[model samples]
Target: MRWLMLLFCLGLAACQPRPVKELPAVSASQSVAELYRLEREHHALSALADVTVTRQGKRWSVTQGVVIERPLRLRVDAINFLGQTLFQMGIDGPLLQAYVPAEKKFYTGMATLDNVQRFTGLPLALPDLVACLLYSLPPGVVESAQIIETAQGVDLVLAPGVRYETVFSSGRLSGFRYRIDDLTLYEVAFGPVSAELDFPRRIELDVPQSDTRVVIALDDIELNPVLSRQQFQLSLPATAEEVPLNEMEPVDDQTVEH
Candidate 1:
């Protein structure tokens, strides 16, 4: 019986995958209009704020400060709890120049700029993506919104490529579960986190298969404020290592290993 129990546990662990859920159905056109209207009413702005991202079962987490100056400039300063800066980047219009002050090293590359912009989860940029996430969107819409919902929330089986099972409400986002859309259990439960602002203040992502979880919270939002050009300037540390964005080669690994 003990051997059987151990086998069962192993089987379960091997069977688990990421989490993903889908919504029922809604008028995509109408939903888009509503989301756009919300942005206009809120008057989105370029600003900076503190961010914290946590994963499942881990007491240690990631804390960072993100600054956005608009049209296309983002600087993410990631640090540990000790107030030590881990990584910093100066993004000027799609260019990601990351520098490590302590290590005296830097790397330049192209990043998922569009993804970051679309999913700001903040009140920056003209068409806010977080607002869209709350509303119903067309599935396969814009090639990025993997899931869309018009009706009932969703239930997802765990599998590879699984996303989170999320239910958008008028309050804080919660019960965020992630698994493959095809494998999630037939039924799931969810509750609102808290609805203080138009955007999601808190989001809970659950991954039963991998036993992984993610919690995201947003605060200190400066909606639709004026920004100056100086904010986007790349203030590189003196004597720190530097690399040109074009110096790095493409990541096609089918060739020889450099």
Candidate 2:
């Protein structure tokens, strides 16, 4: 039921990520070395979060249980204010699956970036997906990173393939942009890192292309928690209507409340 509203709002607008810039030629200094250390800081994560999705000035949210591991394993369960399980979505390797309890429908598809964009309004591939959640860069990105030292802080830039700058103000981790070629895909702003857990307390994601935003406030985070195989597993139930992810077209907005 809650997800239904989110799906509707999604069709109204589009993924509205923040602005990203093209790559500039700058050399790395000791300042950029710090970025390398950020890579692979966490191999696994388990947490509970207040996940809010926004579109066209409309907001919807859910209490989400999140589990993620390296090499593309993920699980997310959305629970509403009434403690009802609204939906469940997960990824294992290249496989994607989701289930809606109210509709008794299950969705399945390949775990590609486009599918990710369609499902969560985030334009990220599996590896980069983990990077966004863990606040780390993809493997070897730092090796090819450039630097722009500002009076405020350092701006780390990447090469053509993925051209985005990671901003650090006053020697602290702030956030970054994500881009493909010349197009800015999205932007992320990070919250204060929890000294207790070494993990960020909140993450704000924007997809400017579609005007969509997502805010995740993480709580009770466990770094590298032991996750069971069953957590990433989902079976199509015989009673549920099996729907492929590609088939879930955006509903015509003429029928929705403007």
| Residue-wise C-alpha lDDT for candidate 2, range 1-258, written one tens digit per residue | 999999989977676775785432333354466566566567889999887777667766668888988868988887877889877888988999988787798989888776655545454678877777877766656666675665433554675456666676545567877777767788888899877787789999888876768889999899988888789978887889998877876522211111
Q: Residues 47-143, candidate 1, lDDT per residue (tens digit)?
A: 2334422223432345556554433555556666688877666556655566666658666655443323212222222222233333222123223
**Where does candidate 1 have its weakest 10-residue lDDT segment?**
249-258
- lDDT score, candidate 1: 0.43
Q: After superposition, how far is residue 64 of candidate 2 from its true place, in Å?
A: 0.9
- Residue 240, candidate 1: Cα error in Å is 0.2
Which portions of model 1 show Cα errors greater than 4 Å? 1-30, 39-60, 69-72, 112-149, 153-197, 204-213, 244-258
TM-score of each: 0.49, 0.76
Query: How many clashes (backbone atoms < 3 Å, residues ≥3 apart in a chain or on different chains) does model 1 have?
Result: 21
lDDT for 208 (candidate 2): 83
